[model samples]
Target: MEEIFDECWNSKGIQVFVKRDDLIHPIISGNKWRKLKNYIQTFSLNEHSGILSFGGAYSNHLFALAFVGHSLRIPTVGIVRGEELIITSNPYLNQMNDWGMRLHFVARSLYRDKEIPSEYENYLCIPEGGYGSQAIDGMDNLVHELPSCDAIYCAIGTGATAIGIARATSVLVTGILTLNNRAEIEDHLKDFPAANLKLDDKYIFGKYAKSNADLETFCRDFYEKHQIAIEPIYTGRMFYALVDHIKNGHIAPDSKLVAIHTGGIK
Candidate 1:
């Protein structure tokens, strides 16, 4: 974890630190590495034909999995969400291709099923956003590296990271939802203990993968001031919510708060 020194945090009377899990690797950085670690380690190439996962056009999970497949020399297949992406050439998809991940695009309707299609059923299916039990187990181990604090905060995409951290730590875990799917996220976390878990959806900006001028300005100014790259998709929103919470007296004064930089900045 890296300590963030800024006037905003200081003025709020809160000590804030960010877990630099993003620094773990250049390609498979942050919680991506942590979440995929156990799955990759235990995966047997001989036992299964290949690994199949799901994601969107710019999914960090897909990017990281492509790298993992390249490094491990395993055949990886990505079931893309949007069929339109199949005819389009983009950096993310291009990189996945270069990494030897076979791309299969499906309609948004079928993608909502959240299951690997029957034809690819032979391959080991990893869930979208890497939110399976293995990922939770991996992230639970990540919590061991964190220092004790009054509160822990992270951006919630699939809620796997937040749920994993919440289950492993005694401190209150505040998950800032980047998407406007509070009910779905709540259902996902139903099985987990809620003793000190909180979900905040006030700073989604518009919706998942959508941003506005205010968010862009904040991200630009924040990067200039702190030299920490934060994308509006995840980290930026979490930080914005943190600042807002602190300013509004939601977060207690002088509390040591740890904000997890879950990466995917690029």
Candidate 2:
């Protein structure tokens, strides 16, 4: 946890600190590792052949999986979404291929169903973005590591990280939605206490991974002033929402907040 003293928030009498989960690893950083850790640990007990997962061409999940598979000598397979894409489609795709993950691209329609090939059925297949109960344990682990604060904020992608934190802790968890999946997130988190988690979609700007000039500028100024690395896709939107809330007086004065930095591997 790193406390950042910004004059804007400081002047407003709000305190901000960053939980650098990105420092967990270079590739399998932040929630990536947290969400996948359980699956990897129990792989040996299962009768599956290897670890297989689904993702896009530039998926950080597949990228991290490939590296983990390489380092641990565990066989891995990636089901890419776009049929037109291949190992050479992007540098990250190329790297995943080079790390020994067998890549198979399929039609987007079929990818939406997340179906594994009959041949790979024996492989332990994880859902897209690691959206399952497996991630809850990992997020619980993260909750144990966090400091006490009035509220905690994190970016919402698959909703696993935020939901897990919300379920495990009484601290207010605000998940800034990066994608238009509020309904899905609400559905998944319906069983948890509603007050523990709050979903905010105002910072999405347009949609997942979409960014404008203002967001880019904020990221640049953030790095310049705070010396913390953030991208517009995930952590940037989350932190931006935090500051915006502070400035907008959404938070009470003298309140301290924790913003999770959910790393970038793409």
Find the candidate with the highest TM-score and give its number: 2
TM-scores, one per candidate: 0.95, 0.96
- What residue pairs are clashing in model 2? none
Choose the strongest candidate by lDDT: 2
* Candidate 2 lDDT by residue in tens digits, 1-266: 99999877888678888999999999999999999999999888259778999988878899999998999888899999999997898999999999999999999998889888888888988888887889876798888888889999999988998988988999999999998989988888765444688999999999788758999999999999989899988888998999899888899998989998989863
Q: Model 1: per-residue lDDT, tens digit, 1-266?
A: 78887776687678988888778888788889888888888889678878889998998998999999998899899999988776246888988999999998899998999767677777888888998778877877678888889999999998889988888888899999999888877887776655677999989887887858888888898789878889889998998898888877887778999989888835
TM-score of 2: 0.96
The C-alpha local distance difference test score for the whole of candidate 1 amounts to 0.85
For model 2, the stretches where C-alpha displacement exceeds 4 angstroms are: 191-194
RMSD, every candidate, angstroms: 1.4, 1.3
